[model samples]
Target chain A: MKIEHPYLMFLGDAPDELAAKTAIGIKQWRPEWCVAQLSLPGCQADLGLPEMSIAEAKAAGVKTIVLGVANRGGIIGPAWMETLLAAIDAGMDIANGLHTRLSTIPELVQAANAKGVKLFDVRHFDGKLPVGNGEKRPGKRVLAVGTDCSVGKMYTALALDAEMKKRGMKSTFRATGQTGIFIAGEGISVDAVISDFISGAVETIAPANEPDHWDVVEGQGSLFHASFAGVSMGLIHGSQPDAIIVCHEPTRTHMRGLPGYKLPDLKTTMDVNLMHARLTNPDCVVAGFAINTKSLDDAAAKKLLAEVEAEFGLPCVDPVRTGVASIVDKLQEI
Target chain B: MKIEHPYLMFLGDAPDELAAKTAIGIKQWRPEWCVAQLSLPGCQADLGLPEMSIAEAKAAGVKTIVLGVANRGGIIGPAWMETLLAAIDAGMDIANGLHTRLSTIPELVQAANAKGVKLFDVRHFDGKLPVGNGEKRPGKRVLAVGTDCSVGKMYTALALDAEMKKRGMKSTFRATGQTGIFIAGEGISVDAVISDFISGAVETIAPANEPDHWDVVEGQGSLFHASFAGVSMGLIHGSQPDAIIVCHEPTRTHMRGLPGYKLPDLKTTMDVNLMHARLTNPDCVVAGFAINTKSLDDAAAKKLLAEVEAEFGLPCVDPVRTGVASIVDKLQEI
Candidate 1:
């Protein structure tokens, strides 16, 4: 569902900045939509926006209160209920990306229903989607695949979208995860969809567009990660991309959360991604590479990027350090 | 949840044999557990069993009534509700594999709860399951993967399990779909699971067992099918199969339901299945091939099977016509 814009960023008793990373991401990518911040007592995170109460947010024309910050267990804390109710009473929709569904809370559901405002659970998708048909949709798509999950795929996609816009290119950042959903106003969390409908949901998310337009679809889960490769495979096939950007994190020795599992090398990752992607788009090509060099020094990061680019004969960059200009340029050639 | 046996198969006014195929499957595989058949007025299908009413079934010690037939939209007909209530009133649990959940019918739910009998919605799974860890568990696993959906993966798995048992081997058929669940009496519909947990649900379905024990896990969808490769990938990873049997219906030219897409060749299918399967079990091997030669004459099926065996250097047979004797023999070597 489309979450309304001009939002109030909610950081409800967040313990640290990391807890509010999703809110920060929204501000980073869609600053105009982040009108103001709302926080409860003892909240430690801040978006550097002028804090507002429900009345002030409503008066300021905030249409939705986005519960982007997550605390322990990703639950809606008891301390946040009054604030949520007040926002609902003020005729503001609530969009949440937490483990607990807002619909599961009777009080919140009743308040939102009574006020005729919507509750957007960004992590949950409850719409009827057709099964993917692998039809040749009219559009250029570039999916950011990865060597592992949480390896800068989202950031790379956002950067590419931003750079393309700066160049007056028709491009849209397609979100497939919670943080990405907050960054973009609307997108499905593909991983939360039923297994049978993963590809279908992705197909719905990006759909067909102008022949020259590019849907830079954000990826999820590594093909090598045992926990989530299924989601990755579905995303690859449904995207039917003309090109894919391979994302990687250099310093990770093991797969995230599975100590016994090692991440596949960049070459293996790209090769596997291409193999599955070609099922839907037989001409899918490797557009570029996105590396997360946060753990490396500048020299090391530069050395690694250069080596990878030379070896693969593709543009490579850290979306954060290098701004993905080269990758966006490479996308033009594809 | 374990669906109790000694079931009274309900074919509620099924229009034809195909409409009652799932009930037929249950009777074919678990005949001893099928006490009798119960048909409504206008039912055209028969399982060649004595027809019984709810009172007769209860008197004969039938513990469950399995609604194993489907109408046009897979919905439960209002006409069947009376019979279902009657069964529940007689202390019989209900197990259904339909689009309509038994728990959603307040009347049946109320009756079942009052009678202290359970209602099983086999197509739905509502339990806690951990994410697949891809750990090396002790067991010999053989997974039956297919070229597309409904290409006899379940039949092949069941055949393999039956053959293994006939030869005094420790084997079990693990179901992954509704028909298979009816045959096996218990299973989680992997495709129905959330995308993130497809593999995890499978892992739970076939947990650790004796080193010599075999979990003949039935497969779903295909890696080449755009609509459902996600489910296939998850099944492959979660099986951690020591060996995989490739099932194919040679007559089909296109991937199921997607007329624009052609099925991958057997070699390509095997290679891709192995590539994905290797993530969980590095030592995974192709055990054999199970072909659906239903459309071919006996001689043609035999010749085709021989040719495929020669091409792949693996044992190949039609599970229905020739049985899986050679495949079971091949499994012994692995």
Candidate 2:
């Protein structure tokens, strides 16, 4: 779904900073599109943007109100209804990444219909998608795969895209998840799609582009995670990337939510990902590594990165501290 | 959904035998369950069963009227409503495998509610499924993986289950597709599930069982297929099969629905499937091979099977022509 900007970031009584993760991510990645912040009474989080009402946001030419907070139970509680309706009346579209569908709220639906504003629920994908044909499409693509879930894959992708752009290369960030979608302003939440269309949805998200252009596609679940490897496989085959940056978090003892399942080693993870990826793009290669060294001291993180680089003969970096310039440089060979 | 036995197969105005493919498959695999057949005036297909009205079928102890025909469009047409409603009134539940949802028919819904009957739409999966946790569970599960889509995966699964039972082994057939669901009387159409829950739904389909018991799980799609590798990946990881029987059609030149993409070699397909399967079941192995030889002459089919058997040092048989006896024999090691 394409959510138009500039957006009014809605932090509707969010309980804490983590609740406003999506909004914070949007502001961090696409600062130009986040025109203002709209908060309800008792809201505990902020994006540090100019506080604005519906009228003020409209005056600033806000095109959409982004429901970017994760409230308890992910519901649109009664407390947030009045402000949401006011924004709808102000002629701005609504983009939500919540369990509660915006279309489920009758008053918002009615007002949005009257105002001709669109409602985008990024978590639900009902649009028709073709089965993936496995055809090679024109474009150079790179995907950020991971050793496990929540291991900085999205941050690596965005960093790669930014670095590529800074190098004056023709590149675009292709988002495949919620926060990524808000940052990119468009994408398919591949995991929410019907299983049969996972690859097809990814194909649409990163369709054919100019041969010289790079679609730095954001990846999803780990190929080693039992709960979601299917989505990961489809993403790999669908994007058909020429290069993949392996993302990992070394501090985790096991896979997320799976106590006994240890995260696969980076070598196995990369091999498995590349094996499936070769189905669509035979020449797919591992460009580099993105280690989420958040828990590590700078010296320790650098030492680990250097060891991994030495072992694999590829560039390795923490997308946060070291930057992905070397990784983007490696992409030059493609 | 577990559909009751003693089924009245409904071939409502089937234009051709292909339209009644589900009915034909159920009759072939679960002959005892096919008590009778019901047809409309314009029906052109026959299952060679006793013709019975809804009342007659109910009197003969039929518990479910299976809407086993596909109409021009996958819709509950006006023509079939009267018969469907009558069946509900006759105290038989409706189990539909069509794209049309049986719950959408207002009259049928109203009648079924009053009669305390249920509607089973096999194609739609709205039930809640937990995310797969990648834990190894009890039971010996053998999945029938394939070289491409539309190979003999389901047939081989059924054959293995049947032969295992004949040998006094505790075995059950786990269905993963529409026809397999109808034959087994229960299963999740894995492809129809949400992408994130593919593996989770599969774990439900083939849950932990007796240590010596075998769940001969029906596989779907191919790990090598572009359109549906996601489903295949999930099925492999979720079933955690101790042994996998690779099913392949000997005469196919390319992957299904993709003209340019050639099917992976049998060795590659088996290795890939086993590699993924080993995530949960570390000792997973390729138990046998099931070759679909319907397109080949008897001599050629036999020769091809022998060649594959020698090449891989595995039991190889055509489920239709030579039977899957050898494959079941190999499962004894597991």
Candidate 3:
């Protein structure tokens, strides 16, 4: 059966305050989206109110349900599995977006498969706004800000924005993953303000704690965020963007040089998460970018871009070229 | 400081009754090995007792210790981790073998790394065995059997045995793992017969219940029996065998298609077990075989082997090739 008015959910371990804030953030993204904020219980007996949410979803004709399957503060086991099964049996489509744990996947998959339920792996959706017509112009611009974030990612995002804008395309700056949260009071206010200011040419400040939150933001833009967590998978799964940009660490510079660096561990995680996502939602575009130039040396920048393109099979541009002219050029072509 | 004559200990979740028998099995292979078997609680309490024993080694020393890592009929968790750390700190070397729960690898790796101790990821080591050495006329034919009570793993052991015998090489099989307990016997008469038969081939029959009962029967192989409840990692660390072979049901056949079949969930319990094996012994081989080959065909099999080789940069062969003459040709060259 096709699900109608489906609500995407993310299950994970966050502080109680963070959980409440995340719930608020999710609500802001989709005002009409039915969200159940369940506080992870320390024991089976403590699983008091969440049980009712499962029952309510079934009774209220909710077809789709997303769950963050991580227990950050406590241990979840067979009893938790039983609770999840009840939700599925009650006809809630189950999806998982997790980073810290991997064992949970098999059990969740086995449960979903057993009940003939759809399991969406929300790691393949890339959050990119489509470019319409043959015109290239400056699109909307967004500046994502975070403290102690990866500088390479910021540059790549800006470059993409400039390229799109040069074609007369409009784009927005998305503050996603840790950076998004950092700007939104997860850290010092001074640091956040400074970051926001440095992120020049930002049109709209779309701050997102998780990648899936990008779905709600309107406009064509780039996501510039530090992603040590499973942010890449979440953004890819939730957004289904035209392209993706990743900032590579300096020590591990060459994309394909290291054994596990080129694709990174994220690729394996994506393979599993996206396979599930594709099974549920088939239309998705996959692309990637890597930031390499530390200085404005044009040759070095181009080399880095070329390497990124070769490794991820995506179009990459030098970060130095990210300016109004580049944006206009991109907009004219788009 | 580098440890001399270091003890490599393995702790697992074998039933209390089968601990001694498992210890015996281990001792047989390393006659100069010292063997010690201890109950899960006793081991955890740091009761200053040797876990298992083998004959005295003139060169280094023969000391084998096995302890139960999990409680009787209980799921593994943080307590298990604490217990394991204490044991390792108390001078135990490795924990579970390759078949261990995937939830424990990070902790095990951390503990080993912290103490400068060695870890064995059993599954990978056992799975990747070199079928034929590069010498002409092939190397010695060896059949390793893990006899515990888990029927799920019988097919894997049998397949390895069959493959080894098929190569026109003389091979002998012994009971290891859960099946070893049956040979040691608690209530079953089949244990005696199985024990007697295996005694001829195996140097030590690891009785699950008695760790110190190293009974030396004339002409009968040594019996080293001990519990391996969560000690799959231990097997991977210590025994850098030619290859590793595992038996599982059709449900597990999907593992064959994984990036690294032996280390599919390396971050998890299963992968941790396999990783320990791979890391402890870099030159060892790792492979896996399921009893249900119905899901496997020529194309699927070749793809599976290719996946293993690509992930680990190692050679993998099908157990079905035990009868193929080309196997002999490859072995002869090895």
Runs with alpha carbons beyond 4 Å of true place in candidate 1? none
Q: Local distance difference test, per candidate?
A: 0.91, 0.92, 0.34
Worst 10 residues of 2 chain B by lDDT: B325-334
For model 2, residues A1-334, the per-residue Cα lDDT tens digits are 7789999999989999999998899999999999999888899998999999999999999999998999998778788888888888889899998978998888888889998989999988889998898899999999999988899999999999999889899999999999999899999999999999999998998999999999999999998998999999999989999999999999999898899888899899889888888889999999999999999999999999999999999999999999999998899988
Q: How close is each model in CA RMSD to the real structure? A: 1.1, 1.8, 20.9
- By DockQ thresholds, what CAPRI class is model 3? incorrect
Which structure is stronger by DockQ: 1 or 3? Answer: 1
Real contacts recovered, all predictions: 0.88, 0.89, 0.00
For model 1, how does the per-residue alpha-carbon lDDT over A223-332 read when each residue is reduced to its tens digit? 99999999999999999999999999989989998899998988999898998999899999998899999999999999999999999999999989888998878889
lDDT of 1 by residue, B1-334 (tens): 8888899999999999999989998899999999899988899999998899999999999999998998778767788988999998999989998878988879888889999999999888777778888888999999999889889999999999999999999999999999899788889989888899999999999999999999999999998899999999999999999999999999997888899999899999999899889989999999899999999999999999999999989999999999999999989987
| Separate DockQ for every predicted complex | 0.90, 0.86, 0.01
Can you rank all candidates by lDDT, best first?
Answer: 2, 1, 3
Report the lDDT tens digits of candidate 3 across residue range B148-237. 223233333444444455665443333333323222211111121211121111222211223211121111110011111112211222
Q: Give the C-alpha lDDT of model 1.
A: 0.91
Q: What is the lDDT of residue B101 in candidate 3?
A: 42
